[model samples]
Target chain A: MNDAQAPIVPAVEVLAFDIFGTVVDWHGSIVRELGRRYPQVDGDAFALAWRAGYKPAMVRVMSGELGWTLIDDLHRMILDAILPQFGLERLGEEERRELNRVWHRLDPWPDAVAGLQRLKRKYLLCTLSNGNLGLLTRMAKRAGLPWDCVLSAEVFRAYKPDPATYLGVARVFDVPPDRVMLVAAHHDDLAAARACGLRTAYVVRPLEFGPAHPKDVAPQAGNDLHSRDLLHLADLLDC
Target chain B: MNDAQAPIVPAVEVLAFDIFGTVVDWHGSIVRELGRRYPQVDGDAFALAWRAGYKPAMVRVMSGELGWTLIDDLHRMILDAILPQFGLERLGEEERRELNRVWHRLDPWPDAVAGLQRLKRKYLLCTLSNGNLGLLTRMAKRAGLPWDCVLSAEVFRAYKPDPATYLGVARVFDVPPDRVMLVAAHHDDLAAARACGLRTAYVVRPLEFGPAHPKDVAPQAGNDLHSRDLLHLADLLDC
Candidate 1:
C-alpha cells in the first residue's frame, strides 16, 4: 500500500516515534515481567488482557467522559480490573502499584538503543507518545532510551490520532508542520501525522502483539518511508 | 562563613541545576554569538546590556503585571530592546529571533557535561531553569547535556525563586522536597531553594559575567555544599 515511486519531500527536521510498540517490546517485556513476578500466572494471557484494557481506558479520557488522566493512571485503572480477572486477589496495594509500573520498565528492542543513538547524532529524536511526561521520563531512564526530549499527548492534554498531539511537536520546536515526521508501527498514527502536513515513516514490528496475535504482515504504508526497524529507518534517511 | 564540621545530610536523590550560569557559560556564549554576527559590535557590552533587561522582564511576569511568558519570549523582548541599544540595527526580524535563541545554544561549562554524566549514573539530573522547555531541550541537545529529564519553571507557569518552581521538580518525580537539591551559582537562587525545604549546592562561576563583574569567592556555607564547579560537586558526592 506504500507509494514508493511518489516524490519524497525533504521537510522533516525532528523524527518523533510512537513509544510502546514502535520502539519497545511491550508484550514480550510485560509477559517476561509477569512470569518473573507470578510464576503460576498465565503470563501470555495476562499480557494480552492487560493491553486489551489500554485502548478503552484512553477512550474514556479522550472523550472527556472522565477527567484529564495520565497514561500511568490509565494503566493503573486497567491493572486493578485485570488483577481479579487473573485471580490474583492476594496482591497487596503496593505490589499492585509496582506491578502496574512494569510499563515504565519495558525493555527496548535490541536495535532500538543503537538505532536511536545513531539517529540522535544527526536529527532531534524524541518520543511523541500518548504516555505522560513522568512515565516517559522514567521509562527512558530505566531502559536507557536516550531521548533528546519526551513530547507526549500529556503535554497537549490530548491523545494520539488527535491533530493537536501531532502538531504540538512542531509548535514546540517553532518549526513548520512539514518539518516534523511521525515514525510509528501503526498506519493510523501515520495517517493522522500526514493529515497535519507532517512526514511519516512506517516501522514494522511483527512481534509487538506476541506469538498468539499477528500484526499486519503486509507492507501497508501510507507513509513517506517504510523500513524494517529504527536502524533501517536511520539508513534510509542516510543518517 | 564556611562550615567544615557541620553534620552533612545524605545527598538529594535529584540534583536540579539552574542553567543560565550554573550549567552553561551564558556570558561567553552570548558574547561569542554576538561577535560572530556583528564584528563591529562590542560583544561584551552588548551581552551585559542584553542580560540587564532579563530581570525586569521576569519581574513584569512575576508581578502579574504581565501574563505568564516563557523565558524564550522574555529573551526576545530583551533582544529587541538591546539590539537598538547596541546600535546594531542591520539584523532582520528572523535573524533577531534566531539570534535570540543563542540562549538555547549556549555552551556548557568544561566540567558541566562530565559532572552531569557522572551524577546521572547515581542520581536523577535535571535542569530547573527559568528557560522554557523548548529552550532547555534544544540547549541540552546542542550541548550534549545528559539530563534524565529537563524541568523548567515554564512547566509550573512560575519563575524561579517562586516556591512553586522549586517544589515542582520534587512533585514531578514523586519525591519529597528534602530529596531534591537545587544546584546553582547564584546565592539568591540557592537561598530561595533552601527556603523551600530543598538542599542546595553552590558552584562558583567566577567569570560568569566576565572579568568586570566578580563572583562571590568566599564560601558562605549558606548552601549544603560549595564547590568550584560541577566536577567538584561530583567528587564531593563520590560519583
Candidate 2:
C-alpha cells in the first residue's frame, strides 16, 4: 500500500509484534511435535484445536471471571483437556509438562530473523505477545530472535486488545502512542492498536492455520502497511 | 585473582553489571558536560556532588520515607536542589529536565561494547542498575552495549542493595541465585547481592572518580572474581 493511502500517522519508532502466529509458526511446530509424540493422532487437527482454546482461556482471565493466569499455565490447561480427546495417554507428568513447553521452542519463519534484524537497525523491536516473560525469553534465545526487549502481557497483567498492553509499550519507551506501531497477523489486533492512536502493520500468515484451514483474505484499511511477511513489512517501512 | 583463591560459588551463568561507575564512566561524562555548559563552575566538584545525591535519593524511596520515584525523577529533584548551590542562574523547567536526562546519554567505557559482545556469546548478560527502563534502553542503543536484556531495580520497584532487586534477576531468568552474578565496582552493591545468594564479580574502576578523587583500592572477600576491567573479566570468564 502507498504511504499516502495508508493511515496517516507519525513515523513509527517502536514495532511490537504478536508472537505465536505472526513471528513463529505455532501450528506447524505443534503439528510436527504431535506427529512425533502421538503417531495415531491427527496431528493437524490437534494443533488447530489446541490454538482454538487459546483465546477463550485468555478471555476468562482478562474479564476477571478467572484469576490472573500466565500463558504458560493456560497452555498446560489446554494440553491436558486435548490429550484425552486425541487418544493420547501414558505420558508422565514431567514429560507432559515438558511437552506443553514446546510452545517455548517454536521455530521462527524463514524471513523472521532477517526481517527483525533489518527493522531493529532502524526501529526499536519487541514482542507484545500474550506469552509469559519466561517463555518469551527462552524462545528468543532458542530461536535466535534478536529483540531490543521482550515485552509481554505478563508484564502489563493484561492481554492484547486491552488498551493497557498497547499503551504499556509507549510508557516503557517513554514515547508517544503515534510513534509506536503494533505488527500482527490478526486484523483485530491491529485494529485495537489503531484505535489506541498507535500505528499498525498487518502481516499475512496464510499457513498459520495449516493447509486445510483458509486464512483471512479480506482487505483492511486500519493497517498502516499490509504485507505477506515480516521481510515485506520491513521493505514497506523502509527499514 | 586466581580462580582457586576465589570464593566458592556456582560458576556464574549470567553477569549483571552496575552501569554508572562499572560499565560507563558517569563522572567523566557529567564533569565533561559540566565544564562545557558552565565554564565558571567547579566541574569535578559538581559531578561528585550530583552523584552523591543518587544514593540518598534512592534510600528515601527504598525506605518508604518518600513515594516510589524513578532514577530520572530523582535526578531531576537533585538537580533542582543543587543548581543554586553552584551559583547558577535559574534555567527554564524544560532545560533543567533536559539537563537531568543527560544521564540517559552517558557514554560507555572504551572496553564496554567489545567486552559485552564477547561475554554475551558465553553468558546471559544484562544490566542490573538503579537506572529506570527508559534510561537503560536509551543508553544501550546510544552506547551499543550489547545486553540480552536491560533489567533494573525499576522492575522490582526497589533500588539496589535491596534483596528484592538482587533476587529479581534470578526470578526473571528462571535461574538459581548462585548462577546469577552481580558485577559492580562498589563493595556495598556487591555485598548485597552476595547476601541474597548471588555470585559477585568486582571490576575495579579506579578512574570512576576524577584523578583528584580516590576510590577504594582494597579488595574484599565474598567476591567470586576480581578484574581490572570488563575485558579482563571476559578473560577470567574464558569468554
User: What is the DockQ score, from 0 to 1, of model 1?
Assistant: 0.62
| Tens-digit lDDT track of model 2 for A115-135 | 999888889888999998778
Quote the B-chain TM-score, candidate 1. 0.95
lDDT tens readout by residue for model 1, B1-239: 22342246474788898999899988999889978888888888988888888889989999999998888888888888777767867789889888988999999999999989888887888889889888999999988999888778866788988999998888777779989989898999999999989998888899999778877656776688888888888777777
True interface contacts retained by model 2: 0.39
Candidate 1, A1-239: lDDT as tens digits: 22343247456679898999999889999999988889889888999898888889888888989998888888888888888878897889999889988988999988999889888887888889998777788889988899888878866789998899988888777789888889898888898999999999888898889988878845665678888888888777766
Candidate 2 chain A: worst-modelled 10 consecutive residues by lDDT: A1-10
Give per-residue lDDT, candidate 1, residue A119.
Answer: 81
Q: Per-residue alpha-carbon lDDT of model 2 for B1-239, expressed as tens digits?
A: 23443435447777898999899989989887887788889988888888889999998998889998989889988988889989875788878877888898898988889988988887888899999877888888888887777788877788988898899888877679999999999999999999999998898988899788878857898788888888888777777
Candidate 1 TM-score restricted to chain A: 0.95
- Assess the local accuracy of residue A228 in candidate 1 as a C-alpha lDDT between 0 and 100: 88
Q: Best-fitting candidate, measured by TM-score?
A: 1
